[model samples]
Target chain A: MKDKFGLQRIRLSVQILYTILTNGYVYGYMQGKIYKGGLKYACVPGLNCYSCPGATFSCPLGALQSALNQRQIQVPFAVLGFFFLFGSIFGRFVCGWLCPFGLFQDLLHRIPLFQKRKQLPGHRMLKYGKYLVLAGLVLVGSSFLFDGFVKVPAFCKYLCPSGTLMGALPLLSVNEQLRSQVGGLFGWKLGLLLVLVGLSVKVYRPFCQYLCPLGAIYGWFNRFSLVQIHWEQEACISCGACQKACPVDLKPEQISVSTECMKCGKCMTACPVQCLHWRKIEKN
Target chain B: MSFWHKTLDKRPKRGMWFLLFGIGVVCLVIGIYEGQLEDVYRKAVMICLECIGIG
Candidate 1:
């Protein structure tokens, strides 16, 4: 019980810290301009909208797709390197601890108003959904699927619930100009947000599990991330408590780490013997 | 497994990490060389009107 309480506190603290760090410019909300300072050139580790009034940094995924869609095809080394550095270092640790959207989903999942469903139909198969979004929508669609006129960042334009939540909704609420511009796209995004809200109430991070391309990218690097969860196999009793406590239902005893594991430390709290611990991988 | 899945494989030694860091540094240097820092700053200063499907 003490461990669980500590974990909860830690999660709450991290959530609040990330929120403040990413959106530190509280004055920007009053000014109604995206914070365009030197901080804007940096990318936060999590999904933050560049257009958010308070955001001081650009969204890495947005920067990536935007750069990729350019006709000249210059490699966006900053964005790519930013992704490579952080993704390899922390993996989905940011998703579990820092992302505003991730925190929102966790909060929604805690409402106790909806029946929790760990697995929906085709749940196992749906694990690949994020990869598909990353490849087909973000990369290939941007590169090849222009309508012979203009290329759209299809993932952000059509799909990114974060952009809808942080960018579109906020802009429309504040700017009268944006209010008049709302059309089918806005309606579609609103519908998507509503559906996500409903799902998050019942499901654990459905968007992170099955939709976020950035999550998919970070997840890909989890195996080599500097911070790793190491289990002491010798101190083992296979009570299966870790699996029960895992937010995404990943079995802790599995040989391969599930890409879906966000390293949320819930499993560690749940472990009766306290066999799992976070470790910095060492140089041999 | 596809190439994507290979990315999740654990690196056996420090050499692999050095390679990864090397790649990151190369990219970072190229980005700086291309004046992308200035471009990114410029991009940040303006709101992307079309990004949220507003335009």
Candidate 2:
């Protein structure tokens, strides 16, 4: 139990530190302005809203959408490369340790407001929704859809709760002009955000499980990511402790190379025989 | 056995990971050369009304 708590504490600390480091533009928050610095050229490897007042780096999904939405219709190599780099290196470790929105969901899950639903109905089927979102909205809609003069970033415009919570609310709190302009669309997004917040209290990482294209993309690399969880079959005692410890209700051995494994390390701490451990792909 | 052969035989996944990492680096360089960095910066610096759900 002590080891489990210690690992969780370390993960939470890393998540907080990463959030602050990526969104370090203090002046932007005070003045209700987005950072226009050189750092904005790079995309952070997490689901942070670029429109957040304190954000110093760009959101990868937002950047990918914008790149595809341009009239010139060029490939988004930079964003693709960014995904490849981070995906191959960390996989969903970013979700567990770096993403601000993920941290928000984690904190919300700890609220103790209602009976936590360990598994939703059609959980396996529902997990595929994020992939569909990535394919339909983020990729196809951005590439082909247009709103008169400009192309639409469908995911950002219609579905991103992160934008509503981190970007819209914070900006509206300080910017009177922005508040005055809020209309039906903002209300729609706020409603969506509220629903997600409510769902998060009961269902762990509802957004990551069923909606986030970014999470879906990173998940694909889990099988071959440099950092991974290795289940040592030779030393195995099938105690079932790791499964109980898993917040997502995954069997650690079965999900050694699975997309659903967030690499949260809770299973590793729970293993009594210490069979499960973190292993770098490059190491022997 | 040679070092490379031994390593590959032990962990085939390592080779694949390095290949992907290399490809990522190459793509990033090409993107930079094409002024994609500037493009990203321009979009990010602006307060995207759509992202804020106000557009």
Candidate 3:
């Protein structure tokens, strides 16, 4: 059996389309569209701007972060429920396919001439970075690191390449008056973007691989998450084709969620043994 | 396939790193010199919040 799952490719394309739509909205493509009840709904599985020129719903992460910052009640409930619903059904498939930010990273990595490098050369614990980031964001945002409520959403403040590439650049281009008022925070974010872009050329997706809090949340449910990639280890001829086919460098035959696996299904497509399959688990 | 196409398609040339690095530095300098960093940050935050449905 050879790799048959083209889901990753399909997902990647869909993500790219979402990014284009979001970016286009920010860049002034569609200006005056009207929504009835003040367009404040959320995308089911991934990040898409509600205020985005063409966005139809709310952004889940933004809502969660704001709730955390404001100390709201139902916000946590909303976040938890959203995670459970998506986690049970799609698992980390959200990271692989649906996330607009993930798409941005994928596109940036496609830029030729950069040698994507591995930030984690130590033990393979690097996969935990996103979880750590999630924790850091919630903890820091709700409570000051050491002092007051000065903690910004650290992920958006420092690490999110999506914010830098999709939202920041286009918005600045259109709002020239806004561009005239730059400072240290902007400098820091630009520096971060530069590093991310450079690293993307060297690594497949440095941000997703290392720092995305959203990816971390989804990845937590990867193993038993309703949408799962299963391997019939018994049908094993360890040809390592799936291993090589993996863009995120996961050895699909061995482990599933090592932070390296984007669940892109490149392994599923490249598996000559055709042992990989996706199935839904019913809660009984 | 033509040699150029083949070359262009395989992966970026090593020197592309230096070129990107140079461009990044220039942008950094220009952005700093022009003193538009805070504006950029605020804009980034507002837009990011909007994109994700926060704003």
Candidate 4:
């Protein structure tokens, strides 16, 4: 009973934290004061978009795409630096807390009609799917290697629901010329989006769990990344409370901060022995 | 509704394959309607790029 109570509190706390990150801070930046000059700094953390109807800063993905596609290859100094800095410092914390699209999926899954299931043990191999997407789609498909400097943002083109929902749809809806020009490719993407939305309703974070290159990149740092989750194995009795508490269905004590674990800190609160703790492994 | 039945079922895989086949059929139909395969390729690129913001 006490454990369940603690789990509820932790879940509530997570909801509160997510609300602040998604709707409060990021939203404030989106709708806040207008700048005097041209545009503000190009990059900010947590996937908030500069072009978003309510966004304050530029989206990292969009910035990276534009930089790569530029004529001079000016090195995307600010964009690459921001990605490296944030990715190394906090790892997958951005996915857990700030991404507006992640928040959308969370809310959709919370609807009573959506069923939740944990694909465990044998299904672990599926986690490698995202790595392939990063390698095959983003690096290879986007390259256009034979054509010299022609790079496609393959992930955004084919897979990203966020790009569809936040970037393309909003911008396209207002532009009548674009609306008149929709073709088979748009139909394909719309089809893909529908499939992904259905998958998210059925499975938890279907995109992040399967094909988010950014998630795959940060997850690589789950071990050596500056942010770390440590377990006192000696203190732990394998009570399984942490596992029960995990939203992503991770076994936190066994593999805290695993690529699948979002590092949301729920398991920390669920630990009865207080064996699980977070440590800042590297300073930004 | 049984746990084993749910996990072991090939429903998701079958559904995935069916969706792919359906998409292929749609592509072929679109090609036929347009009277060529070339326009289909351009259409695909335009659509994909539209989603990615170039279009």
Q: Of the native A-B interface contacts, what share survives in model 4?
A: 0.07
Q: How do the residues A1-284 of candidate 4 rate in per-residue lDDT, one tens digit apiece?
A: 25534644554466556545333433323433212222333344465433333343445665555445444444444454555556656668767655666666766666667457645244577888889987876655555432344566665666666656654566466655656776766667777777877766767777777777778877755544455666666788888988887778876443434677777667777888888877655232
Pick by TM-score: 1 or 2, better one: 2
* Ranking 1 against 2 by DockQ, winner: 2
Model 2 has an lDDT value of 0.87
Which candidate gets the maximum lDDT versus the true structure?
2
Considering just chain B, what TM-score does every model have?
Answer: 0.65, 0.76, 0.53, 0.44
List the candidates' TM-scores in order: 0.92, 0.94, 0.71, 0.68
Q: In angstroms, how far off is A181's CA in candidate 4?
A: 2.1
Task: Write one digit per residue (lDDT tens) for candidate 1, span A1-284.
Answer: 35755986888798988888887777766666678788877778898877777778888887887777778877789888888888767878878888999998998998988679875679889989999999998998877668458777788778888877877776677778768877887788789999999999998989999999999988876766776776666785878888888878876654125578888888888889988878766576
Which model, 1 or 3, shows the larger DockQ?
A: 1
Question: Which window of ten consecutive residues has the lowest lDDT sum in model 4 chain A?
Answer: A31-40
lDDT of 2 at A262: 86
User: What is candidate 2's lDDT per residue for A9-67, written digit by digit as tens?
Assistant: 99999999998998778888888998888889999999878899999899999999989
Q: Which residue ranges in model 2 land beyond 4 Å of their true spot?
A: A282-284, B1-12
Model 2 lDDT at residue A93: 87
Please give the ranking of all candidate structures by TM-score, highest first, separated by commas. Answer: 2, 1, 3, 4
| Model 4 local distance difference test score | 0.56
The Cα local distance difference test for each model comes to 0.78, 0.87, 0.55, 0.56
Of the pair 2 and 3, which is ahead by lDDT? Answer: 2
**Model 4 pairs whose backbones collide:** A30-A54, A30-A55, A50-A57, A185-B47, A186-B47
